[model samples]
Target chain A: MKNLNEISTRLEIAKKKIKKNQIKDNGTNAASLGKALKISTELVASVVVGSTIGFLLDNWFDTKPLLTICFFILGVVAGILNVIRSAKKMHKINKYRKR
Target chain B: MSLNPMHQFEVYRLGPEINLGSINLSFTNASLFMTISASVILFFLFIGTKKKSLIPSKIQLVSEMSYSFVAKMINDTAGSSAKPFFPFIFTLFMFVLFCNMVGMLPYSFTVTSHIIVTFVLASIVFVGVTIIGFIKHGLKYLELFVPKGVPVILLPLIVIIEIISYLSRPVSLSVRLFANMMAGHTMLKVFGGFVISLGLLGGWLPLGFSVALTGLEILVAFLQAYVFAILTCIYLNDALNLHH
Candidate 1:
């Protein structure tokens, strides 16, 4: 019984250690997830906003689809800009973490 | 009664339906779940923080961890400038987290699954951040649409690009949360229906997948909440610090 108790206590301590490591891993994982999701959403959102604004402007100015087309192109560019900016932000965070 | 995956998202009126003006102001399952989630958060926090013992109980530990987690997140993302907005951000995080979590329970409505709901939340943050920026910097807040260190010739193009990106914040934020919750729950329900349809021997495979999917969805629920809060902090950082 004494030996069994010692082994169980050892097991419990080991389990606790593993749990701590897992928690650390999860923190890093969540951070990376936040980065990845932010980039994707930023990409889509810029385009959507760009196109909507352009379309509305075209309607108001009686320009038909001209402004819409121009804005859509601009939106794509903006989306890429967003992705780059978010990537840079993430990179900066990683550098800070290292220090 | 039918094993339809889409049925889970249907908004049904609960109790007396009230109409004010031309708008339908009926209490819905969505509203009920929202109330439930809010109450659950309050109840949990109330009970958890009640015991301030030195040797902390389980509830106290959870409460403390959540407090520290949001505190740390705000500090890391927004720095000291966002100290004033801590309560609002914390409440947003907890509300969304609870809504996502409570929805994971069977037969519960997922309030975050609706685009309108998430969009409203996102819009509030967007408008609030914009207002803060203007209040802090006056007309200079428009400077946010212009990134630092761009060549003179590229100023107009870059400004437009930045403005477009700025306008997209709420759209992306709301859609990301709404789509993630809706997609995960729908997939879970679909797989669940398959498990039921294919009984005994055949059902085992789908049952296993459903189990795995549930685990993934739970992670997603937490991650989406984190993403929402962190993004808000980042936006707050921009408004507060004017980081280009």
Candidate 2:
């Protein structure tokens, strides 16, 4: 009975240790690279989407370059905002993991 | 060896071409590799879980590890409310992962490298999540576009920005995976061409770089799949919890 209790306690400790290592792994080198990759694409994609919408609206409204120019600026803002938002979220996750 | 690096990305039909009016449904190398990866995943899981034991075999250990990894990811990101989507998220992860890993082989075609394929997958997620948000929150789902503390004066611009960001989800999701895979493979092929062209004396440098790059590409293959799945989870969380 004593041996069984000791083994159970050891197993619990081992499980906790593994969990901690996994959490730490989340913030490691490759994971950071993944986050970097995601941010770049997010930035570019939003700009592309914004400009496409603007261009389409312009074509429909016969406004030519007017809506396109407006949306291009808006797209740039949206892209920067996206990068900041995702960066903040990542920072939060990393800080939480550290604890 | 084809000197042109872009030659590897060329899609050629394997069997007789099947054309349905303007649309071609022929079995190409991309389709073949996709089928191969799907079968490989199916076989791995089937055999892995065929027998249950206290001490699992190597295959079972790997299979179980993947299952738990995805489960934990969902739990952490989407919480318990997202439990029902586990099967979908798991399948998406495994499919993308296998497609990527299989593509790492010498002659295998990468299905996900194509923008169309990844776009379709991302569209499914985007559309499904939107439907789910509407079903769960009804008209209130439109509130997702409205910021909480924004002044009424800036609300219109903010809402437009929000909508643009929302629409970009599928684009970003699809482009990220497709671009990563395509760029990595193209770089690898370009370096390989360098190795061949440089000859025995000068080839050692690019050859060494290729070896290092192959290792990096494998890591990237795994990482991109992981990113893809986790993003899906994050999107699902937004729909389910409406935490934005």
Candidate 3:
């Protein structure tokens, strides 16, 4: 019974070690270039989307720059928020992997 | 050799043109390469699964590895509830991976480098996920745009920002893959041009750089495909789970 418990604990430790290695691999394997590309595109895409909607609405309402300006600002804010959200997620994953 | 790097991306008709009224649906190099990539994937997978021995063959191992890779990705990101989507995510990953890999060959057209192809792919994922969300949660799906706690007065602004962020998904998804592929290929071509123009003596530096860039480009190609598939899984997770 003592031998069985020792073996089981060893197995548990081995499994945990493997899990830690896997998490570390995942954290570092994603190239920084890819992350940069993903983040930059996310920011630009949000801005583009916001401005497009604003521009279309302005055309419909004949407000010219009003909606366009409003949405452009909104888009920038959204883009920053998007960047922050993704950065936080990445940070969380890294933190978990570190542990 | 053509000095113009952009010339590689030209889409000329490959055979007799097929015009549907105003629309011209002629087969082009892009179509050819896409077909090649698809057939290559089909052939590889066919061979991979043909023999079921106790010990796996190399091709079988490769196919199995890829299958498990995608399976694990979905399982991790979306959980077991997303098991039904395994085939879809697998196919998307394999197709994109094969296309990107095939494009790495000299004189081959990079299909994913084009905005239209990536855009269509992103749009499909976006639309499908939205439909799935609606089917699964009905009116509750709208709650995705609303946060848990916020002042009532500021809610509208927050909602608009959330909506804009949501709408940006497809655009970002497509742009990320397309831009990476395009930029990498263009850089490789530019370096190749530099190697030629610089001649034997000066060419060595650019040639070395080109070799390294090729290695990096191959990595980028694989990374972009993985990113594309993983993003799809993440979006699918959002739809299925409805978690903010």
Candidate 4:
């Protein structure tokens, strides 16, 4: 029936309006996903990169724990690499908004 | 016992391949089932609301609520002007929800539990949203990378990192759903196997565990769907607003 179609259309419109409202925060969630991924990747990268560096340093210095500590610190650096990058991007986004 | 818990993830070839000249049309069993499930639910909803009455019934109320819920999510995440996208968004939500819900049935395939399935869905969402961003802002959409309020020295490094992180969204989103659903279901199946094998004594404990896990899996089914929808809305927002 036309009335049924009509109701469906109106319902559709109402639905659209509601979706539009909820979607405004969707950017935040997407960014959150991005951050989560970056953090995870960075964590893995850090452990691998750090431990490798540590092992290499151990080979260089002939010391066990020293390279381990040093590489762990290096891993932290890589992790920070992701964090800072995301933060700066956020910053630019915020700054661009005011202008 | 199937040695490969993940043997269920295989893609099956189907139909006596239909040919449109060079293009072959073959659908997988997974695709077929998903479409069937979606159709069943879609017809159910369409029939439920066939009667146009001022005072709504419970089914109608539920139908209306789902509409509102999805609509609100899109509107809030993607902005009001993004209204044209409602049907697609609605379809996405319903299909996902149906797949997840269907997964709750005994001995049924959890279609979304496979990484390929989840990844395909996530990739579609990612590509759709990325295309929207390009359409809305052209090349300027890249501006999403440079965020505000950093000291002058650190800007360049930040942008590169942000871009890398941004690009990783589809994989992360897909993986989260795939991993959670797959892991939970595998553990459930394993425990369930234990329940059958252990007879009365050991079986009782696993039986209880299976019950608890089933309840949790149901919650997870809903949550994963919500997360997917919510993330889709966010991506839509970026396209509509370009947010940076």
Docking level of model 3: medium
Task: Give candidate 2's whole-model lDDT.
Answer: 0.93
Q: Score candidate 1 by TM-score against the native.
A: 0.92
* Candidate 1, pairs of clashing residues: none
Worst 10 residues of 4 chain B by lDDT: B160-169
Model 1 over residues B1-38: C-alpha lDDT tens digits?
55888899999999998999999999999999999999
> Among all windows of ten consecutive residues in candidate 3 chain A, which has the lowest summed lDDT?
A23-32
Share of native C-alpha contacts between chains A and B (below 8 angstroms) recovered by candidate 1:
0.82
Name the runs in model 4 displaced over 4 angstroms: A1-99, B2-4, B7-26, B149-153
> Interface RMSD computed for candidate 4 is what?
7.0
Candidate 1's displacement at residue B27, Å, is 0.7
Clash number for every model?
Answer: 0, 0, 0, 32
Docking category of candidate 2: medium
Which ranges of candidate 1 are over 4 A from the true structure?
A1-24
Judged by TM-score relative to the true structure, which candidate is superior, 1 or 4? 1
- Candidate 3 at residue A5, lDDT? 87
Best by TM-score: 2
